[model samples]
Target: MTQQDRRRIAAGLADGLSYAEIARRLDRPTSTISREIGRNGGPSGYRPQQAHQATAQRARRGTPAPPRAAVPAEGTREAEGAREESAREAEVIEMAVRAGLPRMTARVHLDLLLSEEGRRTAAELARRLKVSPASVSVAVNYLVDQGYVRRERDPRRRRDIYVVDDDAWYHSIMIGSRQTLEAARSSIEAAQAAGLDRPVGRRMARAGAFLERVSLDMMESADRWRSLLA
Candidate 1:
C-alpha cells in the first residue's frame, strides 16, 4: 500500500474508527486494515497518529526494521557496514529499474559499482547475481563496450574485474543524447522529404528541432566539464 493510504488508515484508526469503517472508506479489506495496524503499530496499544509519525520518522531517516541475522555476529562494525552498503545498493538497483533499466542489468551494474573493493571478478558477480559465469562475462563486456564500465586484470587473482567509475552517469547521458539526436534528425529529414504540410509533419519538425538544440547544448556542457577537469 501507498504511504498516503497508510497515513489515512492510521488517521482513521487514531480517530477510533473500526477496521470495517476504515476498510469501507479506503476501499480495502477489513482484514488488510487490521493487519496493517497490527504490523505497523502495536496490538495492545495501537495509536494511528503515533504509528503514522513513527513511520514518517523512519522514512526520513532512511531506516528500515533490522533484519534477523541467520547467525548473530559479535557486534562487528564491518559486518554492519557491509549490510548497510548492500541495502543501499539494492535500493539503487530498484530505482534504476523504475527509471526504465532492465532489472538484471541494473543489478549487475549496481553490484559492480557499489562493491567496497570497487570491482568484482566474473565468478563473484555470477554468484551474487545467481547467474552463470558466462552470463556475467557477457554483461560485463556489454557494459565495457558502452563505456559504463572498464575491466582491469587482477594480477594476484588472475581474474578480470569490472570497474564502474564515478562518472558513469555522465557518459551514459552523453551516449543517450547522441542516439536521441540521431533519431530526431532522421525524423526531421523524413518529414521534410515527404513534403507533407500536415500538422503531424510540422509537429515532428518542431520536436526534431528542439531535440537537436538540446543535444548540442548537452555536448557543449559536457565539453566544458571535460575542459575544467583537464
Candidate 2:
C-alpha cells in the first residue's frame, strides 16, 4: 500500500471508522486494509511512515526467485503456497522490527517459532535467513541470554537447536522479575546509605518501592497467566 493509503487508514481510525468503512473509502478490499493495519502494528501502534520504510527495506532485501523444476501438480500448488507464506512472513518480520527487534534477530525468532518443532540449528537458521552462520550464532546467543530462546543439543547431529516454546516466556518473565528485584534492592539500599532525610534519598526510596511492587505484580501475573500460555 502507498503512504497516502496508510495515512487515510490512520485518519479513518482516528475518526472511529470501521475496517469496512476505511476499506470502502480507500477503494481497496476490506481484507487488504485489515491485513495492512495488522502487519504494521494494528491501530494503536501503527506508524504510517515507518510502515512504508519497513516495506521498502524488505523489497531491497528481496532474494531472486529460484528456478522452477519439473514437479507434479500437487507439488506446484505447494510451491505456490510456500510463496504466499513467505509474503506473510516478510510482513511479520517487518512488524517485529518496528516493534524494536533488530531485523536479523526478528527473522531468526520468527523462523524458530514457525518451524514444526519450534527449533532450528544455527546452520539451518543461517541458510533460511540467507546470512552467515556467525550472524545466526550471534542472534541466537542474544536470544538465549534474554531467555527468549534456549539451546538443546541434538546428539546425532552434534549441534544445538535454538528453541522457542511456552517455556521461553516463562524464563523471560522470571529473568525480568529478578532484575527488577535487584534494582529495588539496590535503590532502597542507596536510599538508606544516602540518608532518607535527603531529597535524593527520599526519591530513590519511592522509586524502589514502586519497582518492588511492580516486580511482585509481574511474578503474580506470570503465575496467573502461565496455564493459558502453556
Candidate 3:
C-alpha cells in the first residue's frame, strides 16, 4: 500500500465506509485494506502519515511487506503476522457477507478458496472453520445450489469435497448476464405486444433496447476477459 492508499483508507474510515467499499474504490482487495489498518493503529486511530512513516521504517529494517495475494492462515512467522493475516481474512469474509452471502457460507467459501487444493471435504472445512459439520453442510449446499461452488466425490476418501474453481467468477458472471439478457428479451417482446407506436410503449421499447445492448456488452466483455482467471 502507498501513502495515497493509506490516505484513502483513513478517509474512507472517516466517512464511515465499510472496508469493502473502500477496497472497491482503491481497487485493492478488502484484505489488503484490513491488514494496513490493523498494523497501523486501527479504525478510530488510523493516521495516514504515521502509517507511512512506520512502513518506511519497516522497509529500512528489511521487514517484508505483506503479499497482495491471500496467504495461509497457519504457519505465520510471528504472532503479529498471524494476527494481521487473520484480520485480513476476516475483512474478506465481511466483504463476502456484504455481497449477500450468509456469514458461515462466506467463511466456508473463503476457507476453500485459501486452501492449496481449491477444495475441501466437509470434515476439513468443519475442522478449520471451527464450526459444526452441519454448518459446513448447509453453507456448501447453499453455495452449490447458487452455482458458486461444486462438489466432487473423492474416490479414495469415499467422501465429497467442495471445490471452488477458477471459473467460479466467470460462470457466475455469465449466469447473471444471461438472466439480464432474458429480461431484456421479455421486456422488448412485451413492448412490441403493447405497440411501440404508442408513447408509453415507445418508452418501454427504448428502455428494453438499452437493456439489450448493455447485457450483450457485458457478456462480450466477460468472455473476453475470462482468460485472465487461467
lDDT of each: 0.68, 0.78, 0.80
Model 2 over residues 1-230: C-alpha lDDT tens digits? 89999889888767656566788899976656755765665555568898888777777989422323332344477756654564566567657766777667877998898999998889888666666788788888888987999999999978998889988998889888989989998999999999999999999999999999999899899888889886
True lDDT of residue 221, candidate 3: 93
Q: Each model's TM-score, in the order given?
A: 0.58, 0.62, 0.58
Residue 60's lDDT in candidate 3: 98
Question: Which candidate, 1 or 2, would have the higher lDDT against the true structure?
Answer: 2
Best by TM-score: 2
- Score residue 134 of candidate 3 by CA lDDT: 92
Better of 2 and 3 by TM-score: 2
Top-lDDT candidate index: 3
Per-residue C-alpha lDDT of model 3 across residues 133-174, encoded as one tens digit per residue: 898899999888766788899899799989999888777777
> What is the full ranking by lDDT, best candidate first?
3, 2, 1
> What are the candidates' C-alpha RMSDs?
12.5, 8.7, 10.4
**On a 0 to 100 scale, what is the lDDT of residue 142 in model 3?**
87
